[model samples]
Target: MAQDDTPSAFRLPDPAVVSRTMADVAERGQRIVQDFLKRQSDNASNGGGTGGAGSDPLNLAGAFMEMTTRLMSNPARLMQAQIGFWQDYMTLWQHTARRMMGKETGAVISEDPKDKRFKDDAWRDNEIFDFIKQSYLLSARYFQTAAASAEGLDEKSAQKVDFYTRQFVDALSPTNFALTNPEVLRRTAETGGENLLKGLSNLLGDLERGKGSLQISMVDRSKFSVGENIAVTPGSVVYQNELMQLVQYNPSTEKVLKRPLLILPPWINKFYILDLRPKNSFIRWAVEQGHTVFVCSWVNPDESLAEKGFDDYMQLGPYAALEAIEKATGEKNINAIGYCLGGTLLAATLAHMAAKRDTRIKSATFFTTMVDFEEAGELSVFIDEEQLQALEDKMNKRGFLEGSEMAGTFNMLRANDLIWSFVVNNYLLGQEPFPFDLLYWNSDSTRMPAKMHSFYLRRMYQQNDLIKPGAVDLLGVKLDLRKIKLPTYILSTREDHIAPWQSTYRATQIYGGPIRFVLAASGHIAGVANPPASGKYSHWVSDTAPPTAEAWLEGATELAGSWWPDWHRWVSALDKAQVPARTPGDGALAVIEPAPGSYVKVMASD
Candidate 1:
């Protein structure tokens, strides 16, 4: 069969990502299911699915029957795997805790004992022996409950429910939960004991063989090699923009932007997620539309930068970016666009600059941004006192939060979808994971400075005071978002986990400026980076008065395509013009790479 000359009928370059993804799940799950079923088959090979005879013998038989049924159903072996894992995990946990106390400085390298975010810690500072105690208690409870319930019921029925319910209880035992929890009291509790003796010791007795672990795979690189359009010269809207090396990609266009543009992205992630490959970049589209866009690309922070708190970001990140734009364009105020954490930062900047009486940034646009922190949702589960203390202790020692720690927290929010989903596809399925460009990008992670994180959690999560007037103390300066009197546009996604949609809507009430609110289709990245013609995605109405998102969605109109193009229209009205396109930059960038920049190169990193 001749392959079509046009884009393949698959629509995507690779075979359908979704179908392969589903198959990966089914196939991968088959193994664990197979393993559990084997165990069940042992118990019930000759026995009936139902138990035989009276109380004593019948109870035993029914218990056997339930195990066989669970096995025969071919249910996943994750629980079994998770169970065995916890056993080994508890053993290691105890050993690690004991050895941790022997460290040179005695730092312990542990999480705050009070948080209880990870473990079944009924009290602060979990004791290692609690593992044994809790495990016994759990098993006892299961036995007691089952024995009692089975006493009054028909022998067979009682046995099955009791046996199955016991399995569920055993799965929830203390040893299981504690070991799997990421919030280990101490990092130094790592299982590795470095020495030739330790390695050789394990070699002799333990029956160990390497098994291919299940995990999600990375996406393939772009096959369609298309160069970017980045021509910088005069007769453009960004003409006479100042060129500054302190700032990146500075172009001296000989004129100030009558309509200046500013972009905001979250620090937890790299900036270029929005400025992704040229085909789907929001920044690239804005530049093509004759609007001047200034984007902030924050440098990943290291331990040395831990002392640099939220104030520095306000001053150097958005505030500095705005200043640079103003100096380059010679404009007093520029339009702002923020995505995710950057959106949160922008909202803060609006509040801060307004408090300082600096009104340089006007016409703000938020992409999936949130200002209200009252109901932070399930993600808040990891931020209680115990977890916070443990985090603080660890952060104090390291000075900066590890990227993996932050990534792990977000992963727990959707273990089935984000974490286990990948586990099923890549490692277990035995097939190279389908390479979707988006997942590849999502896998690319970043780091956060310790100080900034603490400030964010305290000011935003614990206080919920930033949205209220005069709450945050950024270098002793109070930030009130309501003071920022610029025209604002807030955007939120329907399926966002990080910044829930309704949280973004709360911005309407917080801001004193006139606002146009948009509800986009898809999750965080899909909603913002969404190009005009990806698939069937929809968004809610663009509202003005009575800024409630609910009331607006009900009364307001629906737009068929992207919030990007419509946003471009709404924003242009703030700084409208019929002028011709301007030069790309100050004619300084001799080699114009693509708009997405180097950050977006989605390689298959294991």
Candidate 2:
């Protein structure tokens, strides 16, 4: 509902099955039933098993009887639910009769106030429509309650059922139907059926582009370009390696912190999420705050880099950038920030540095990164043994995991906003996607190398290795979060599904440092990119570090403004004396091009 200039950092599936598979399954089932029947017939004909003619029919129907008994285990609960439903229906009927007798102005079946779909007057004004809407809503509520009340289901299985139930309920909304939706019908008449034709064309285009699947593009790509329009933060690409490019932003302040700020963004996405246009650019903001900013622009890895593992990223990404930043700024000590997966890598790199006694990293900042994957939210659902094997098989076929696959996973977390909303707007309404810079960045996805991705999932999500000391060996050392004692500032978004705030809060427990964890409002991208100038959303802050994330929330003070200023203050305290601004290529590292280097421009492989 609110405005966000930057897209979600998470910007962020196919079915093809021959009929032969289903036919085979059907034939197999048929054979089993036929064979069982034949066995019974043979036994009866020979009188080898039992005498059927003399036997009671109930004895022959034993299997059916057993199944029915098993199904009615909670007969009391079933009866109570039936009684409750009938009671509610009768009450509604009585209320409706009263309303019809001029005692009430509206229908007894009022839509749930919490229901966002039927907020329009049309749904409320017509008693018939209101009844239909309310009935569906009530039914949906009952279904969800039934799902929650289900026995013998694990938490994950119950959650999956609940999520699917929501999807089912969302799909059947009155707004999605043409005839039931007055607004859509009104638009249809106003357009003289033009909208329908355009919708068909749009649907066909999507199916064609998506290879028989519907992929609703969130932005009009034709209206925007990466460097020119969206990622327009003023900076120069000062350093490059096989894994990443370091961009040194042009300084806004005359003097800057002696300890230069180095950013490690997730290779899963382009680095421009931090530099999304000048107005909301975090990189631009850092430069203006008298800090020398260097961002890592990760390569859109292809098949050639499939074998590149997590260790490769550690050495080539942060380590390489650290060397380049030191050379460029002549600053021995550096302040570092890592975002999402980037933050996870930063934590590992920090631990590695601690083991080697490398003190170049003075202060560490993490933006929505998870060190412990114990409560990894919905993402854990995709990381089981079977799913991992399937993913590996898919990635093996194509050296790198496709960007769209990653995007789809994140989109599933918020299907209404990311998927169905687009479905209604782009396909049903036949409208061109909005020309949004954030959405454009979201659409411009990047690939992940197979080996690196596999290692990451297995180690972090599957094995739960990173947080455990001596569990994960990276760069010839056991990666331990407890070893790192650098001054740390960790931030997590309140509404982030990708890196849930509570999951991110685990870092405070793992990191053996003076860690300050702040919970910002909004989602993954918007939360981090929020500018104080906009004054859009409020953030929660506290000095106390509690054992549990919930306890932290209880003590945290709700502050009105962006967390950027708080971060600037925190980093300022740790920084050395201010020195004159240093330009890109002014020191050891030579300039390659402008900021947002060639790596970002490389489109996802077809």
| Candidate topping lDDT | 2
For each candidate, give its TM-score against the true structure. Answer: 0.59, 0.85
lDDT of 1 by residue, 114-190 (tens): 42322434222344444344445434553444344322354434434554454444444333332333222121133
Query: Can you tell me which runs of candidate 2 are displaced by over 4 Å?
Result: 1-75, 82-116
lDDT of prediction 1: 0.56
Estimate, for each residue in 1-606, the C-alpha lDDT of model 2 and write its tens digit: 864434221110011222443454455546555666786787557644544423432122333344335336766776676677677666666765665565764443455565556766767666656666766666666666655555655555555556656767777776777777665565666655445555656665565455434566888889988889888888899888888888898888888888899999998888888888788988888899999898999999999999999999999988988888878887788999999999999999999999999999999999999989988887876766656776786688679998887887888887767777677676566687899888888878899999999999999998889988999998789877899998999999999989899999988888888989899999999999898898898999999789999999999999998999999999999755899988888898888898778889998845
